[model samples]
Target: MAPATRYASGVSETAASSPLIRRIAHLDMDAFYASCELLRYPQLKGLPVVIGGGRRKEDDLLGKLQAAYPDGDWTEDSFAEKLDRIPVEFFPRIEGYTGRGVITTATYAARQFGIGSAMGLMKAAKLCPQAILLPVDFERYRHFSRSFKSIITDIAPVMQDRGVDEVYIDFTEVPGGQREGGRVLARLIQKSIFDATGLTCSIGVAPNKLIAKMASEFNKPNGISIVHEADLQSLIWPLACRKINGVGPKADEKLKGFGIYTIGELAAREPHWLVEHFGKSYGAWLHEAAWGRDDRPLETESEPVSMSRETTFDRDLHAVRDRAELGAVFTRLCEQVAADLKRKGYEGRTIGIKIRYDNFQAVTRDQSIDGYTHDAQRIRQVAGQCLKRVDLSRRIRLLGVRVGTLVKAGTAPHADKPYIAAEETPYEQADLFFTDD
Candidate 1:
């Protein structure tokens, strides 16, 4: 990798003359899931950490944490004492924990040994034998995620959530667009997140989302990189093809075959030649990506077309014998769906259900409501109706609920209508429903 170039000398001239000096910042949590684990077990700070587990185990751990520390202020020493009290049998064993699952996330320490998200657990163990592995505590992580993003919202109003791990923030309209204001604001946000959650992150300040995303990864854990428009050729052009957001395995392999392995090489290619080799749409996109031209906006609200929750059973249960048991699971799924909508400040007009039989045949059903809603009771009722339409004779391995036709929460709901019912049952709501709670 090439060293990132800086334009510290011509800041004034560039800011005044450049028409495309859009201030964008990309903030990514440093190994988010793994980092959250280490915050509790500080002894695991320098050690390799991995987070993965099934629904039940994760829920149980989250429930204990929520019950013990509702305020999210447990210290490192207190957390260590709590962990020591738990029995080893309750702790997940590498050999016994099995499934067709992949690692949800891993720490920077684990990444050093060539481990990463989506790698198989067995393979990760082989890479780092003594690595400390933990289950993904979705509820706790979601709580912290909301907390940090809310802090960012207070400082920078326009933010686009990439997922639980990262966000793209627009700082052009903020007071800190010129001078070192962007970097200064990024440092403050990073510090605030650390102080609030005891978690650290890497941030990149640049002219657009494309450059900002690339710049963020330039620095490792607990670091920042700022890239101005004038620094593009010296800094962004030398990166490998894989660094570009949309260039995946197939595109990378093809680029390598053509000896177009880096952004610099790709930029050197003729536009006509690229169009002839790749398709018109992709070829044009590749050329522009090389030049670091991205006009993507920073979205504050989440506009999801569909919302869903799914879990794989420890062992496949018979659909007939497990019908009663499945009811609880189905209700939990609906509650989670409703909670997700509430947190994102969204309401869905369409409700759907999905199931995967033991034979791996997937089935789905959907229904549109007369009005949009984020109420748990309404979502559960609609989901229940959809479930009855599906064939339940086959054994089920997984069940899920989905909601679509989403819009901003308050847009459709009248002031008099209560969106989320106060008496709604709390099934998986504890784990799935959290809005800075």
Candidate 2:
């Protein structure tokens, strides 16, 4: 929960006039995926809409629109313009959804039904049966992500890209950034994004990233929050320890066990007592976090550690009965991963596969190859070998393939070794049950 408005509205005259006061802003797109979907289907606005499930079939919405309005001048070239005309009744609902897919994001309206990101579709169905279920459209989402981030960089060049829909911007040096403790810059950014994309965002500006992240959530859906170093006690300390960003469920539970629920409680403990209980590094970090102290600067540029792709099936399938289908999907996943790696100019030596059974338990297997290459067939080969180590007798709900231990392509000594497949007998080739693919 957020504290009263005095902290957000008033910055101490002393701190405001200080020679140097760092101001960092965390901007998070509100209901990002769902909002992107709303742009294509404005009729769904203000209605319960959940944006997740599997990938959309090619021109599925176009086909539905054409079928529903045979005489309504719908053409492939004009499909984008006609999206807003789609009838709400034509959308898929969660009422009888049986998939094991989890939501990626949901509209604020649907969230009131307790539907949220990572929640199972079936479970969400029970809460909001009338919620429109749209398959994930990452292509559109990425376009918007790039658009907004580009705008942010144009305004604040020193910005850290956190993910597809969030960023930490250094407002300390930007013009007018210090006015009202960064609220002026935050409001300008919010308006610029909304004007460009018709999307909303919430921003929090604070002395550092730690408190800025928490402040971003204080007022959501196109709201701005400000917190100064002096407001730590009245503003930041009242929030739960879990809101500290790095504190996860396990840490929160352990903190609670020590009678520490709020940041205030954590702050009350002596640094030595916390170090003795939590450990040297984490304990010391906790004490600093509770006091809203973070000296880390924004990381403006970073390389990705790995890349992967995964999908949940419309229904669980047995390994033996679903071998052909599973094999095709398995091969496609490797191809997708390889395509991604090559597109990004990277190669990984480790190949891995993940399996989630009907019971929702997941298992992963991976092996390090002698050389790194972003070759689809080779990835499938090494990944197939890794797959042989997992139990396949049970029904599987989801599958994923990944490559890790990455390096830029051609940077490694054994980067591009030509792959020579061993000629195998039909029995051996078919052994993995993916030969048909």
Candidate 3:
């Protein structure tokens, strides 16, 4: 096979070999949600912890206790000692969970049992019943995200924010960026994040974004991997095609049907053949991606296309039998989505709802309104209409609400249809799934 590029970084034969090589680093927080929780509850370290579901009364009690004694002065020794006094049993466990919540993220230890983000808490319970469960705390996560990104920008100014836990940084120009093929800088960033937040991250530095993304996952959890152009065939080709990032389950299955399971196999096929099969744009992009050829630059700032919130029920909810519960949950989701839009200073013209049946079939319905609005009641109203459009005969396992076609709140709204049609067909659900690394 011809040479294929993979990810590499930090002090090696390739370091300083060529100043022209554009070094891009992808840094990902390891078990980010769980790690953030660990900062608040250091006692949970090394335990099988999962962060998901909703906040419980226990969480509220803890908050009150901590607020009453902000510095842990209630104890004789220190806050650490006071924290230790809290029994392990005080933490909620995934066992016997009976809600429609999914694991947001699991600690590496819990991940050993085949549970991860998007897996139902009930399903994860079957794998590791004793795993601890915590609620999603976006406020804390966002704080850490800003802190860590600030650290990166201080080291390497040209960084692109990719969600709340990852970033793409350009290391081609930083002072020590070129040294050791970007390892020195990666190490510094990792140490800086750990020192500031008591969290760990993994980084991969390569010639471009695509290679760097794959490399970041190579070692994982406080690991740094460096990939060079020369390391492509040896490091990249043997991996499964899905490791390429864009090759999702559906795409991977199609590739497998074609007897192309690895990057090497995908690269061997002619670009024209891929285009003929997968269509013009995506096919050609896939061919280039398989060959480890990507020239996309780091986008320092990009507006979000949409904001959404969804949840999977612990048990399937019958549309009629659980009407009240479902209605409340549906309203809450729309409220949450609307709040997200308002918090981000965006209003959207398109409102949509997603439903997944007990049989795993997923569907979506969206409608465009005359003007963009981020009001909770308005969103809930439109989303409820979208819900009415779907066939509610099957029991629902998952529900989601989305707001799209966004614009800055102060700006003029787009020209949209005066009224939305009520009978939109079902579409596949596109819930974001975070994987265990």
Candidate 4:
């Protein structure tokens, strides 16, 4: 079984010759979404479970329980309180799934069958048809994400929030940070998170972010690895060139063409040779990254440039036939994006819509307004206008809404002036599909 979560690492310049050494730790949560699901269905432990697709089958599950155990009075409340009572056979399997849905994450047990995140559900079914398929419950996962993150911050004040699953923590000043190269602090933080959320994570402590990021992958679930500045040649350079964080597929392919498949090969090249082939900035970055050199500070506070919400339908939906349903989803996406903006204290002037046709062709359109807003209706109105420009004659497999050109909610130039509201947004044609109706 492979571990789940991925946390970004920090950049440090600590060296053996320097008087000061900075220890940076990169922590990755193990199978975050699947682990959260396991907490709700403990009976599924040690079994192959994959989390993805549509919303949880609450009513469907309750109905199944009522039929299987007529005397149990398995209402929705009972189903929630007694989830463990449900038989394993009652759950849906990936065996016969027919959809464009993708897996968010799968349990370690499922990974043993070659299942992984971002793989289409249908393909996963081919690999492990008997794997239990569960719906993604982001609300529940977010609750656990906050739980574990709060625990980390309580122990170490200087922590970087990477995402819902992983984080980067500065261990230079904390007590016991230098003991065994930050292993003591790492253990404390890992134990604290597990104690609070019943979750496990892997940590890598090193002199800088680049090596730390690579080191975190050395151990699997609930493990730790420590690296020092002196270990760069032995532990880092022999890895593939792609192992360097900055090298993408294209760059790696180019490096391979130049007979530089390993980080050691990249480090051996003259800086001028790399700069001649790659761009000035990127090539220089490649040289530095290959040598495990980074001095970036952890970002404690940050602002987002945009916020969005998107969903892939369980089935392709026709624009006209699924008018009401499409309208509801589009409106929900707008509301969700608006809620995100409000929660983050941001408002945006640019609103956009993205859609994917059954043929897998995707289109995007955006328009900027005079004033910024985080209101759902405003976003829907603009997004609807953007949608009108797109040919929705084909069935849509996915829908998304985005709001960009953001500013702090009360900080836009026209903050005091009232923004004019446009006419209500309509779905299909002007009168054909999406409507208040």
Q: Which window of ten consecutive residues has the lowest lDDT sum in model 4?
A: 1-10
List the candidates' TM-scores in order.
Answer: 0.59, 0.65, 0.62, 0.65
- The lDDT values for all models are 0.71, 0.80, 0.77, 0.79
lDDT of 2 by residue, 1-437 (tens): 11111111112223335544678899999999999989879999999999788888637767887888899888988876777877788888899999799999999999999888999999999999999999988889999999999999999887888999999998877897889999999999999999999999999999878889999999988899999878989998898999999999999999999889999999999876886798755876787688776645566575454567777787787778888788889888988999999999988877777776665445666666777878777788777876787788888877888777678888876745634444323323534633322
Residue 305 CA displacement from its true place in model 4, Å: 21
Shift in Å, residue 376, candidate 3: 46
For lDDT, candidate 3 versus 4, the one ahead is 4
Residue 333 of candidate 1: its Cα lDDT? 79
| Candidate 2 collision pairs | none
Off by over 4 Å in 2: 1-18, 302-437
- Candidate 4, residues 1-437, lDDT tens digits: the string is 00000111211111233333578888989999999988878989999999999887678888877887888868766667888777889888999999899999999999999999999999999999999999998999899989998898788877788899988887876887888999999999989988888999999998766777888878978999998877888988889988877788999899999999999899888865886799655765677677676645466665554677888787789888898789889889999999999998999887777676665445667777778899887788778877877787898877888887678988998787646555444333333224322
* lDDT score of residue 403 within candidate 3: 79
- Which residue runs does candidate 1 get wrong by more than 4 Å? 1-20, 56-81, 84-99, 302-437
Clashing residue pairs in candidate 1 (N, C-alpha, C atoms within 3 angstroms): none
Instruction: Give the TM-score (vs. native) of candidate 3.
Output: 0.62
Supply the TM-score for candidate 4.
Answer: 0.65
lDDT (Cα, tens digit) per residue for candidate 3, span 353-395: 7776664445667666777778776777677666777778788
Q: Give the worst 10-residue stretch by lDDT in candidate 2.
A: 1-10
Choose 1 or 4, whichever is better by lDDT: 4
Candidate 1's TM-score reads 0.59
Candidates 1 and 3, the one with greater TM-score: 3
Candidate 2 vs candidate 3, lDDT winner: 2
Cα RMSDs, all models: 19.8, 19.4, 18.4, 18.8
